[model samples]
Target: MSSALAQTLIVMPAFNEEDAVAGVVAEVRAALRGVHVLVVNDGSRDDTVGEARRAGAAVVDLPFNLGVGGAMRTGFKYARAHGFRYVVQVDSDGQHDPAGVPKILDALQTHDVAIGARFAGEGDYTVRGPRKWAMKVLAVVIGRIAGTRLTDTTSGFRGAGPRAIEIFAEHYPAEYLGDTIESLVLAARAGCTIQQVPVTMRERAGGTPSHAPVKAAVYLGRAAIALVIALWRPPLTLQPEAGTTP
Candidate 1:
């Protein structure tokens, strides 16, 4: 936890994940030594806050459920307020592997944002049927919008350097679809380097995935529309005044 070593904060957004939060926190703590873990308990009906706290994470309880975008926004606000130099976003569903944290941190050595691409390497992780199709279509659209080849646009497992964190904290899209894509696109547009690393994703360990088949379809449809709207509008620019630190 020395000042010389970048202060890294790992943000896990959980909703009704009481069964998995403790295990997730333990894995992340073991994998990424010296990193602070912050759990955004997004109004979980279960005892997610208690479990996370028991697992040695700093828990931030939301007054009510605000979806994924709101939960992550809270994490970003915490990162900014606490002066963390790096922020890592990990899914609480247990799909993302904490073991890949080293690769992500290494990638950030030269890149502003390092994303874990589930489809990048040979692994047991598989997104099949309609979900796979939806991801493919979304990836193509995101790549076109960002003018960069993006293999995984929807993966929540990613790392953001201080510059990217400031930008996200200042203007994270309030909507779900726009929130994920806008962060990456904005980082690239601001001359921040973006890179990807291969990582394996596993099935959820506890509660069911929030995105069911029908829900996935609806999300894809909405995401497509949002992407079009986002493209029509100009990208937002970061307005950091001199000597200001986010």
Candidate 2:
């Protein structure tokens, strides 16, 4: 195992994905060598905990369904407490490809945060209607805020280096859409450099999808609200962790 792999942790946030969690964990383990895989079971009523453990992933069970942001915050805290230098967010439903993780981690060498972008000319992933328009607007808006061009600002397949790991471990927002949208604003405001790499997204191996085509319009409104909330917040005062360059 390489030194970088040794210091990295893959944080999978699972919510009622008992059927797919184990397979996703196994795929991630197969793709990334010598990296710790921690699955945060977000109050799953099913056997997500047992499935993850059987798949060789360490599990952290939440008391209730705190959403992705809350579950991710727990993952960040685990990464921080356990002395991991990097944390990559992977979905438990198997949409995110594990093979793309190393590209994200490589970007984190210089950037404080790295996103696995879907619309960067490397994948067949496509969205339409209000959700698509909302995503484009968000990319432009948040891209300007971060002083960099971003093709997919709302991508969940992302990684945080040491500096961002320290900040997110304490300040990651738990609101709706906060994990992807608000969290970027928070990291950028906290003086974290953000970047993205092209990655292909796959269909979910099992379980029901979270978003439906019928909810695209609602998603547009909520996305706009989330962006506003992110921008309205005051800048975070962040200091670099000891032994890590800012």
Candidate 3:
């Protein structure tokens, strides 16, 4: 296989997505030809693992639910171990459009990380009012901390090149923070070059959102505080091994 064909892996974190996981995996496989797909089944109570495997993705079953952060970190560790050159993170809720995978891959050629920004494009879907406000607030806070204007700090659709994959696999934040903003901010502080691309996301097709509106606001508030504290203090330094790219 060509280098581009062999080096990419789509990492999906799924929780009780038995109904949607298969379709999402198939879509990713179809959209990114020659790229492998790995689904981190976070102790799902249903048949998520079996469906993911049947849909042509390799499955990593967590012993118990570790939330999104834990599942994604597990995928990152696997990417680092297996020497993948790029890792793309997507939710299994059927909201993210897999057709945009190529755009992310293209962005990775010049950026350490490429994130899909829902607010950056002409997306028919809009975030819930409360969540939208919270995202805006968090973005401003993260921008001040990272010294850059970050538009979509709470988006889960993101791509990490080799260097970023290695760094995150080694030293990702431990606590679950709902959105991936904290990790993105930490990556920025660590001197990673991050970029964002506009992508349209559809409304979720199956399964209820893990967070309700009020719960999401509270979660974002706490995570924002944690991110500020994390920025003030230096993070644990991790050295990449020889020959590792990310």
Candidate 4:
């Protein structure tokens, strides 16, 4: 195992993703040799846990259904408790190519948060209507807060280094849209440096897309509220754990 791979954890928050989760986990393990992969089976009604286990991934099954944010909190806490120096969040639906994980992990060496950006000149992923507009606005706003340029602020393919991992394990948000937008705002407010790495995206191997065209307007409004709530809250502070190095 490479030293970097040994210290890093790949977290996949899966919910009813039995059809795709195993393949995604296998791809991650194969692409990043010897890196630990954890699947937070968020109360999946299907065979998510069994499939992930068969694919050589450690499984943490939640008691009940929690959205992506809640599942990720479990992941971050697991990483913190187990002394993982880095945590990368990858989608279980296979849209996030595992081949890009190493690039984000490499970026984590310099920045606290590394976002695998599909809109950053690498992928053909596109959105229309209010959703696209909301994304552009969010990129502009969150980018300023982090003191960097970001084209895909809503990207789920991201890695957090030791500092970010410590903070997130304690205060990760669990509300709707909190996993992506609010999480970025929270991290930036807490003084974590953020950077975007260009990455290619693929069609999901199974399951339906969360957002449909009919919900784009609603998504725009909800995204604005999520960002506002994140910023209105006071800055989050991290208390160092005894005898632990972040």
Against the hidden reference, what TM-scores do the models get?
0.89, 0.97, 0.89, 0.95
TM-score of 1: 0.89
Candidate 1, residues 199-240, lDDT tens digits: the string is 988888786676667676566677766666656667666544
With a 3 Å backbone cut-off (N, CA, C), the pairs that clash in candidate 3 are: 162-246, 163-246
Clashes of each: 0, 0, 2, 0
lDDT of 2 by residue, 166-216 (tens): 889999999989999999999999899999999999988887777777888
**How would you encode candidate 4's per-residue C-alpha lDDT over 1-246 as one tens digit per residue?**
378889999999998899999899988888888899999999989999999999999999998998999999999999999999889999999999988888987888778899999899997899888889999999999999989999999999999988888888888899878999999999988878899999999889986576777888888789999998999989987654467443
Tens-place lDDT digits, model 3, residues 1-246: 336647988899999999899999998788777888999999899999999999999999998998888888899999988989888887898999987777788888877778888887648757766567877888888777556667787788889887788778866665656337768767777767677888888888687697776675576567667666667667545444367443
Return model 4's CA RMSD, one decimal: 2.0
TM-score of 2: 0.97
For model 3, what is the C-alpha lDDT against the true structure? 0.80
Off by over 4 Å in 1: 1-6, 239-246
Task: Pick the winner on TM-score between candidates 1 and 4.
Answer: 4
**What lDDT does the true structure give each of the candidates?**
0.78, 0.93, 0.80, 0.89
**Best model number under TM-score:** 2
Which 10-residue window in model 1 sums to the lowest lDDT?
A: 237-246
lDDT of 1 at 175: 70
Pick the lDDT winner: 2
RMSD, every candidate, angstroms: 2.9, 1.1, 2.6, 2.0
Candidate number with the higher lDDT (2 or 3): 2
TM-score winner between candidates 1 and 2: 2
